[model samples]
Target: MIDPLQIDDILASGGALSKYFSSYEERGDQIEMSKLVLQGYEENMAEVIEAGTGIGKSFGYLVPAILHYEETREKTVVATSTITLQKQLVDKDLPTLMKALGKDIPFALLMGRSNYLCLRRYLDNTVSQSIFASDPTSEDGKLATWVRTTEDGILDELQALPRGVLKSDIASDFELCLGQKCPNFSRCFFFKSRKKAESAGIIVTNHHLLFLDAKKRCDNDEDYTEKALLPPYNRLIIDECHNMDKNATSLFTQVFSYYGFLWEYRKLVAVKHGANASNLITLAAGIVKGKENEALDVIKELESAEKIINNLNSILVMSLSGSEQRVDKSNYSFFLSKYSASLIAIKQSLDKITSLLNSIIGKTAFSDEDSYIQQGINSAICTFEGYSSFISEFLNIKEFKDKVYYLTREKNKNREEVQLKISPLEVSDILRESIFEKLDSVICLSATLKVDREFDFFRNQVGLDQREILSGCFESPFDYKKNLLLLIDNGKVLYKNNQESLYFDHAAEKIISAVRASGGGALVLFTSYKMLEYVSSKALSELAGFNILIQNGELSRSQLLKRFRDDKDSVLFATQSFWEGVDIPGDSLRLLILTKLPYPQVNEPLFKSRCEKLESEGESSFMMLSVPSMIMKLKQGLGRLIRSKDDKGVAYILDGRMNRSREYFLSQLPPCNCPDDFLDESLERRIEDFLY
Candidate 1:
C-alpha cells in the first residue's frame, strides 16, 4: 500500500500543487480528504465524501488517483456530471497537475460516440454536394468547408457552426455506423478516440456514459461485456455524486418520443431529391438477386408503419384537446384507459415494421459495390429494433409497478404532438447490481451530498451499503460567518394565498427592493418557469434603470453569465439550470434571492411514483426523501453565495415556509440573521445598511 504520509507531504503547504498554482492556499480539509481517498482505495472499499465548496476537492482526488495509477499501473476512470467540469478537468486541472509533477501521464477525454463526426456521413453529404454549393455563404457551404479541414471531427472543436448542424448532418449515428466494414474504418474518429482511451492510464468521462456502461455490464452477457464502449477498469471516481441516482435512473429507463420516430422515418423515406433508405435499398438490390422484392416489401411496411404512428398521435392529441394539464400523469390517469386500443395497435404496427426490416437485411448478401447501401439498410433495421424495444417496455406496464408512465406534448415546426415516456421510481437496486457490485473501489464526491452533517440520505439514494462503505464530510475553508448572511422572510403578507399573478407581483416588489438596496450584483432564482416569467416581467418594467439579464429565449447560460460578470451593477433572473454550477465571486454578486424553497414538484410522474413506493415500504416519504433532498438543494443554492474568503453576500429566502422549517433549513446553511419582522420599514433600512 502507498504511504499515507507520502500523499500528505505531496499535498502539504509546500507541496507540488502549492508551488504550481500561484493562487493556491493549503487547506487541512483537502489533505484529510486526499488521505481518506487513498486509504479507501488501498482497503478496497467504497467511500462517500461531501467536501464543501473551495475545498479543492479535484486536486484531493486527482493526486491520489495519479499516485495510485503510477504505482499499480491500474486504469482509473473519473466520471463527472456536467460538461463544464469535465472540460475543466481535461483542459485545466489534469494538465496543471501533470506539469507540477513533471511526469508524462497519459489521460484521455472520452465522450459519447454521437459527439464525433462520421467520415462516411460527412463524405456522403459533401461529395460534389449540390444542395447549397451555389451560394458560398450558405450554412451548408460553410459546413462542407469545415468538414474538409477538421482533424479531430469532434463537434466541440467546430465553434463557428451552429449546435445541431453536425448532429443532424454528419455526427456518428450508432445505428448507421458500418464499423470495421466501412471504407473509412481506418480513419474513424470514434474508434480512434476509443483506442486512445484504452491505452491511457486515466480516463475522464461523464456520469451518463459511465452508468450506461454499468448497465451493459449487468446484462451478464459475455459478448456485450467484451464489446463494451469503455475499456476494463476496477476503480471509479464520480464527481457531483448527488446526480448519480437520477443519471442511473435515466439510463435504465426507456422512452419512445414522437420526434425520435419522425427522425428515423425521415431517414428511410426520400424527401425533396435527397438520398434516403429507399434509394440505398434499390442500389443494394442491383448487387443481390431477389433483394429488390424484399427491399420493396420493407419500404411498404415502413410507409404503413408511418401512417399508423401518425394516426395514433392524432388520436392522442384529439383526446387531450389542448388541455396542458393532460401532460402531467398525476393530474390525468384516464389517458391509458381511454387510449388502450390505439396504443395496442401502434405497438403491433411497430413490431411488424421491425420484423420486416430485419428479414430484408437477413436475406441480402451484397458485394463491395453495395457495401455503403447495405450499411444504410442495417442502420434502418437497428433503428426499427430500438423503436420496437421501447414500445414493448411502454406497453408492458404490468412488469414494472414502480415505473411511472406518462405522455407529454412537444412542438416541432409549429406542429404539436405527444410522446410516451417511462422512468423507474427508485434505482437503488439498479445501481447496486449494475455499478457498485462490479467495481473493486468507488469514490463518490460532491459539494452538497450531506444534510445535517449526515450521509444517510445520500447513501440511501445511491444504494451505498453502510457496512461496506466509509463516509466523511469536510467543511469549507472560507469563513462564512464573516462573509455571508442568510435571511428568511418574516413578512406573512408574501404568502397570502392569492392568485399566482398577484403573488408574483408581491414577490417582484421584494426582489426589486433587494436588488436596489445592493445596487445590483444580484442573482434571483426561481423554482419554475412560470414564476420566473412573472417575476422577470414585473422586475423588468419596475427596475428599468438597472442592467437586467434574464435567462430565457434571448441568450445561452454562458452568454448570460458573461454579461452579468461584465456589468458590476446587473441583476440576473434565472430558473432551474441556474440554481447550481454558477460561479460569481467578489462584489460582482452581492445578493441572492430565492423566490421559493426548492421542492420536488409532486406532479412530476417520477417524483410522485417514488414517493408512493416509499410510502408503501412503511417509510415517511417526506422525512426520508423529500426533506433531505430539499435540504441538499438549499445547501447548493446557499453555497453559490460565498465562493471565496473575500466574497460577501446576503441570501434572501422569500418563502414563508422557512419559518416552520427554520430549524431543518437553517441548520444546513451558513451564519444567518433571521429577524422577527423583515418587512417593517425600519428593518428594511437596517438590512440596506448591513448589506451595503
Candidate 2:
C-alpha cells in the first residue's frame, strides 16, 4: 500500500533530513523502521519495532507520522513512557522534524490531571489560599502571582512552592475539578491542555496518562471516541513499549493504606496549632447558611473512617495476629473477617459523608461571585463518593477474574503501615480490547522489547499477538562488539543456592575492584535497594578515594544524575529507576555492573499470583514466566553502557544466574566480546584493558 523507496529516500543523505543534521549521514535501520511504521499505518494493524540505540528511533516513526498527518489531515497520538521522553519529543525531536519538512504542524503535550495547578483550588481561601497573604508584596503573594502568570500551569515548573502543599491539594484533580461550573473555568489549566489537543495534528502524552485516558474512555457505556480528555486519534505510537505491562498494571492497581488515609483526613480536616487550617470540613461548615452543624456532620463520617482504619491497622499489626503478608478471599478467616468489616465500615462512612455533602450542596447556594464555594463542595462530594465506590468494588472486588489481592504491613522508621492492594494478574486482555482492538493502527517500539532475540515474548505479554502484527528487531547502529566487552561471572563465588545468600559480600569486592580499575564513572545496578546499600557499604570504605553517589539518599534521582554526569570520575550506585532512562555517554560513564539477574521477588504479591496461576494450568512457571521477563530486564541493564557509536565501555554482570541462559540472552545483544572464561581477580585488569 505504501512505497518503501519513498521512506528510504527521505531518510538517506542529501535528502530533506540532511538539512536538519550536522554531519547528515543516513541510518539504514531507521529507514527500515520507517517503512514498517508506514506499512502498519496503511494496513491498520499493530506493528512492533525494536530500534536499537542511536538508530534515531523517534524520527523513524515521526517522519511517517508527520507525512501522514499532512496527507490525511488526521491526528496521530505519540505516547512515551516518561515525562522526559515526552518533553524530548515536544522540545527536540518534533522541532527538528518540523524544520526538515518545512511545515508548521501544531502539537501539544498533555499530562495527567495532577501535574497541573488548579486555579479554583489555588484561590479557595478557606482551604487552599488561607496560607498565602493577599498582599502582592509578601513572599506568599509573589509565589501566588508567579503561579497566576506562569506560562504552563504545571506544578513541576514551580520551584518555590511552599512545603505541605501536596499535589492533590492544589493540582487539578478529577474529583476536585468543577469544569465550566467553576468561576475559574475560563483559565482552567488541566482542561486547557486537553482542549489544546482538540485541534492539534499531533498529540504527545506519556504512558500513565495514555493508559488512564484509555481506561476511562473504554469503561464508559456510551462511546467516548470523540469525547473525553483526549482528542479522537485513530493511530497511536507507543515508544518504550516494554513498560506497557507495568504502566497498565499500575492504572488497574488499587491500594488503600492507613497512612494514606490519614493524609487524606488531614487534607480534609485538621487542626494546626489549635487553628483551623486549609481543610474541606471547615470550608463546608462556613458555607452553610444557618445549618453549620449539619455541614460539620461530615466530620463524624471522617472520624468513623479514621476509627475503622485504626482498628484494621491494629488488628493486622498485633503480634498474635494470624494475618499473613498476602491476603485474599481464600486466606485466613479471622483476617478476612476483620479486613472486610473494616472496609465495609469505611465504605459506609464515606457513603454517609457523600449523602451529607449532597444535602449541604442542595441547601447552600452562592452568589455568582462565590460560585467556587458551591463547586468546591461538589468536588469534595466527588472525592468521598470515589473512595466509597473503590471500597464497594473491593467488597465484591471487580469480578476478581484476573486480579491479585493482597494485604501487607510495611515498617516505616517509627510506625508500621498496613496496606490493602489489588492489581491485575494480567493486562493482556484489558489492553487488547481497550487499545489494540479499538485503534485503527498501533505501533509499540522499544530498545528492550525483544527478550532472548524474539518478539514473541513481548507480543504475547502485551496482547499484540492476538491480531495480525508486523514486527522487526533493528540492531543498534552502534558497534557494541568493538566498543564494549560483556563480562559474565560464572566462577566459584556464584550463588550455589538461594538460601546460602552470601554472594553480595563477594559481589561487593568485585564491584570495588571493578570501580577501582575503571577509576570510577561506574553505574552499579542491584535487584533491590537493600542489596545496593549492602554493596555500596562494602565498597564505600575501600573506594573512599572515588566519589560515590547512592540512590534512596539525600539527593533526588535527577540531582544524583546531574552530579554523576558532571563529575565524570564519580560512581552512581542505584536500582530500578536508574537502570534505564539514563543517557550518560562518552567518558562520564565507562563502566556498568549489574550485581544480580533482575528476577521478580518471590514474595511479590502479583508475581507470586502469576506463578501460581501458571502452575495451576500445568505450565512451567519458572521457564514460562520468570526467565524471559528477567532476560528483558537484563537487556535493559546492558543497553545502558553503549549509548552512542563513539561511546565505549565495559559492562559486567556479577550474577551467576545469567550463565544458565547466557547464550540466549547473549544472542539478543549486539555482537560483543562475551568472554566465557574470565577470572575474578583478573576482572579489574580485563576491564581496564577493554576501556583503554
Expressed as tens digits, the lDDT of each residue in 71-179 for candidate 1 is: 9988889999888888889889899889988877899889888888888777665432556744558766666676667666777665444334436667788777778
Candidate 2 per-residue C-alpha lDDT over 1-692 given as tens digits, one digit per residue, 9 for 90 to 100: 34667676679887788766778889988988898899888888789888888999998998888878887877899999877798899989899888877889888988888899888667653333545556666556766777768766887665444555555667786655667877778888887888888878899998887877777777874243576667877889999989999888988888777777775666566442225354555655666665578656777777877888888777767732322355555654655465677778888887887787777667656666545446555765776777777676667643444878777667643577667777889998878877888888899999888765668878877887879888897888888778989898865677545743488778887888899899998999988876788778877788988898989656768789889999999999999998789988989899999988888777677888888888999999888878888878877888888888899999998887667777777776678988777877789889888887
Best by TM-score: 2
- State model 1's lDDT: 0.76
Q: Pull out the clashing pairs in model 2.
A: none
The segments of candidate 2 whose C-alpha lies over 4 angstroms from its true place after superposition are 1-4, 123-149, 158-161, 181-186, 221-225, 270-279, 314-324, 337-341, 363-368, 389-401, 408-416, 496-501
Clashing pairs in 1: none
Error of 2 at 29 (Å): 0.9
